[model samples]
Target: MKQPLIIIIRSINFSRVNKERNKRDIERNKRSKMVSSASSSEAKIISQCFVKPKTVSETSKDPYNLSPMDHVMLSFQYIQKGLLFLKPSDGAIKPQDFMETLLQKLKDSLATALVHFYLLSGRLSTSVTDDASSYSVFVDCNNSSGAGFIHAKSDLSVGDIVGSKYVPLVVQSFFDHHNEVKAKVTELVDGVFVGLSMNHSIGDGVSFWHFFNSLSEIFSSQETIDNNIKLFCLKNPPILRQVSTGSVYSLPFSESPKSNPQFQTQVLQERMLHFSSEAVRSLKSKANQESGTTTMISSLQSLTAFIWRSITRARKLQSDQETTCRFVADSRPRMVPPLPMNYFGVYISLVKTTAKVGNLLENEFGWAASKLHHVVVEHTGEKICSEMKRRFNPPCALPSETFYDPTIVHMGNSPRYDNYGCQFGMGKAVAVRSGNNDKYDGKVSAYPGREGGGSIDLEVCLLPEFMEALESDQEFMSPVSPSSG
Candidate 1:
């Protein structure tokens, strides 16, 4: 007989009475552990990421005024260094030099006219000035106390990962309700942190990458960096002006009364997992065979099934209830004639799947997983896409009083960044950590790498019981394949 795989799911929703008690118990334990851990070792805590711009010469201003699209392009100049360690011997690669190099590379490699527009858009406001200001570059770094390194903050360590709080103006609405959300990023003793925020209103991940590629090239060489990356001044540059009356770009919350915010602010919870490229492939294969779907679809299905099961177990939900999971997809590819790969604009669509509480806890795991795959497929069809397009472009809204509550959110990291060598003379880091958005019940980001044959670095957040169950499960904690390192 084959050994069955085990997964732990801790549910977040509990009867109101039990929720507070559970949260208290978790918090108490966390505080105790933190005290004990801090007393035992030298560690540091750090703030979220923040970026400082290079002061430009006012006299050298280009003839063309900056557009919002230019600001979106400029925002893409930020990069995430997965794992970077200091090499004290490399005298030339100081932090400032690395940043300047990166800026120059972007100017040389990508000359799209929109870069000018993005830069212009960003200049209008330091924070939440315009729609193009929604793009954000989140810099994640580790906190260390070894040797010459100083302490970061109260909650971080030599290898702990933390990032900028949110995606620029995209989360401005959250700040409007709570001032803490707008707090400035502070200095850290042990870790390097910085984030560039742009308007997600202007671009998606693909466009961000395009702008990053240009920046990377310039960062790699000063002399080779080109001045022509500024495209807005050129004739016939693409335009992404806001549609004044289009129903698609309107916010559903616009007409609704503001409700009290429920979550905390700027606080980040970090977690990391390493899966060998080969092991990820094997699991993907197994998952594909089990669900008969594409890699992403299968992975999403299995993971969702696993999460729902684990959460239900922790919640001890009685049979016959229901729950939901939501995933975001970039829709730039589906637009008419397809949007530019480097078009700096916000264009995303969502796919949601809901299952009965009982269906998740059914006897067979594979069966439950298959059902999830089917549901996701059904939810991502033409009608759904068309409806989403219509909603974003012109005019539509969910009914009043209806809230889009998501228990889990998932995103895939762009794999291309790996080739850029995020290290600036520092040895490559052993692990990279991306923090979470507290706005959701839980979040997961998937990153791809070449070594160990291609695996993903997963950042996850869950209730204590759910986290405990997930880490304790052999199927999840164990190496998927013998070669997985």
Candidate 2:
């Protein structure tokens, strides 16, 4: 009887062990299946795709006339380009999520944005009235055409483009809009690049930023289903005021059309130079001290002065040679009655200051600052309005003589745009750039620094030789943070 009982106990123990092993095996198989499923989902990569408006509006087809200012800008049929924003991959958000949900969200938001910016949905056309001599170009807002939206995957990483020595031409290619305002999204290995290519005739930098801000605002408010997207609508929408016949500046338009001048085919190199708040403050103080003036110079003025002087010196131009610094100042506040902040048009005037290379390089920093300040101050409301009244006209173009010259440095964009704040659910852009605008030698684009706090990023382009000289200048390089390059 004792032997039989011991055998029974052993049998019971064996059965219990068998049960536990079976349970463990089931769980292991379940986990393996889950892991395999996740791997398969993650492996799904969207190599290329196109996004179009989910819904089209009837008004999109309505014919819209270009503002006089718009006509004036048409002469520059080239693309006004910029990196809309770029954010690194969020660890919490998987690549699959980006490929699936994020892309759809972007499309939906963009479709909504186009509803308000209807002009972008249309194509350009020219119409001639009974007077054969007069011809007008207008945006055919009839929603027959849609803004371009492209999604592409690239092996290149974000670091390979941003903060690199040159603007990535491959990345810029993503913004090819065929002369229309278009947006693109390209996925890199570790991050994403968003870019915009708008026709220069459509708007200026401020208008461009406003449109982008509106798009971002709509995109971020997605959680609130009932949220209304607001845009500029006025009882008396601002008109492109006519120019008086007696204008100080000549009408830039030509009766005979001419091909756009192509600059030297030599490749231009772009370099991004960073100035921290501390560095900017030091430069400003140095300028004030050197000028021995009680009046304080602004950060923009000080930095512009320093960069102008540095470029002049780096180029090693003749002492008697003349160098011009040209930048567009916003004319909104300078209008008789300040234009509404939402006025959707180009309200800017070109302010050009010229100096002998030797005098500019030899003068105290304050002198250069003073020169910039004077040009800015002189463009008061009365002055800008007076100038606009004089030169404003329809079917006008920029003067042929106004072609870009290596001796002239053109400043584009501004630090005040707050580009770093242009976040789209993903974190803020690690870096922002003015895309192909940097293709031209002697072109400089400025953006607020990533760290905020009054820092500035100067995207400077020059001939390879001048860039080499500027990069090596100890005094010029002193203000540039090593991490920025």
Number of the top-ranking candidate, with lDDT as the measure: 2
Q: What is the TM-score (0 to 1) of candidate 2?
A: 0.79
Tens digit per residue, CA lDDT, model 2, 1-485? 00000000000011122345334434433232212221211112234333334455575554555555666765564444444334333566666565457567767776776666656656777666455556666566542446666665544445555644555444444454245455666655555656666666666777677767776676677777553534323222323333333422223332664875564443566667889999988988887777665467788888988888888888999999999988878888777788775666667788989999989988888898888877887879988767666766433666534657778887778988857655677667767755453356687887888888888889887877788789899999998995442
Poorest stretch of ten by lDDT in candidate 2 = 1-10
Residue lDDT tens for model 1, 1-485: 00000000001111122335434434644432222222211112222222222333232132222233222233222222223222233556664465344333332222231233323222222212245423222111111110011112222222222222112111111111111111111112233221222223234555444443343333344444355533223322334433322211222222235885443332223344555665555555665665543444454455445545565565555676666655556555556556654554555556566667676566445555666566555644465557744543433333322333334334344443453343322244333432122223355555554352455555554455555666677756675322111
Q: Find the number of clashing residue pairs for candidate 2.
A: 6
TM-score of each: 0.57, 0.79
Q: For each candidate, what is the lDDT?
A: 0.36, 0.62
Q: Which candidate number has the best TM-score?
A: 2
What lDDT score goes with residue 295 in model 2?
Answer: 62
After superposing candidate 2 on the true structure, give the runs of residues whose Cα lies further than 4 Å from its correct spot. Answer: 1-62, 77-94, 227-263, 292-294, 399-401
Question: lDDT of model 1 at residue 30?
Answer: 45
TM-score of 1: 0.57
lDDT, residue 421, model 2: 53
